[model samples]
Target: MGGTWMQVLGLNWLVLSVTGSAATMGVVVMLQSLPVLLLGSWGGALADRLPAKPMLIAFQVLRALLAVVLLAGDSTWLIYAVALLSGVVGSFEGPVLGRFGSALVPKESLGSALALGSVLSSAGRIGGMALGGILVGITGPSALFAINAVSYLAVIGALSLMRTAEMRYLPTAAPADRGVAAGLRYVRSQPVVLIVLALSFVLGSLGRNYQVSMAAMVSGPLPAAPRRTASSPRSSP
Candidate 1:
């Protein structure tokens, strides 16, 4: 969550600096989210079948590599490509992490675990944004990208140290019960779950794209003349 928030802050600043156009930044943000919006259900289905830990490790590695790519390139097209890839990996990673979290506690303690998870996620977001904003203002977005890449290593390392035997593993669904369609059917059978998911989808799609708004505000109202170079300085504008 920290790495994700850092990337969000750094990416928004970087996009504004590079294009100096809020419209282009909006398009980039959309490209980043498009994959997740389209394939999130498929990703959840995959989570139902795959082992979450290995899948999470793989996704984290991919995200770290994508960050490295962003750090290494200056092309707008390449940035868009990295964003797309990150979204693809993130779509799966989100659900896998949720399921993994559920498995970390007994059924009776699940509510507490989820509540704690929410608190931690909120804290991580706040810390990441604060630190990322400061770091980007000082060192630049590339440095934040590098730091985020290293953060992934910390997560991978921690996951590596976890004992699988101690985890409360959820049983894999039968073959007939697996896949996107099956998941949809299950959701449809549960009215409360279906309603919640529908509301979440609406909220996430329409109301939750803070990066787009942030980029527009920075580029529009908070304009600061950046260094006249292909690589723009990562400072507030």
Candidate 2:
């Protein structure tokens, strides 16, 4: 997650530095998150079927490659393509991470584990952003990106070091209970689920993304477009 936050900052910085268009930044963000709307359920189901550790390692390697791809070129189309591809891969990888997490702890520790994971993730995001901001002054976005790529490999190393034999494997979803149709059916039966989904849709699509707004503010009345937009609210974690 630290690496992820670093890349997030670097990517937004890259977009702002190159194009200086908030709308384009918004498009890049949309491309990254759209896959979850399109393929989340399928990815969740697939995560249940795959071997957790191996798949997780593979996903990390792929993410590292994606970060490297950002460094390989600065073309607008290439950035868009990488953003879309990263989103697609992440839609699958995110679920696999959840599945892998379940294997590492017993049922009794599940709640504690999840809470800790969330806390650590938030901490990582905050620290990573602060560190990235400082590093941007020293090394620029390319170095941040390269460091992010290396961070993925560090995660791979940590995953490789885990003690697999002690992990408590959770049972996979039964065949009849898996798939998009089954997931849809379950969601339809739960009103609370529907409400949550509706709220998530509203919040995720409307409230969360502020790239264009920040860009406009920074470039307009603010008059510090480049530096501000690069580290502005829109780009912040």
- How many angstroms is residue 206 displaced in model 2 relative to the true structure, after the best TM-score fit? 2.8
- Taking the tens digit of each residue's C-alpha lDDT, what string does model 1 give over 1-237? 787789878877777667666676677777878888789888888888788888888988998899888888656787788878877887888889989988889999999988998999999999999999888889888888888899999999999998878989688888888888888799889999989989998998789877677667666677752333644533222
Lowest-lDDT window of 10 residues in candidate 2? 228-237
RMSD of each: 3.2, 4.3
Model 1 ranges off by over 4 Å: 224-237
Q: Any idea what lDDT model 2 has?
A: 0.82
Residue-level lDDT tens digits of model 2 in 2-118: 778888878777777767677888888889989977998889999878777888898889889888998886677878988899899889988888888888888999999999998
TM-score of each: 0.90, 0.90
lDDT for model 1 = 0.81
Against the true structure, candidate 2 reaches a TM-score of 0.90
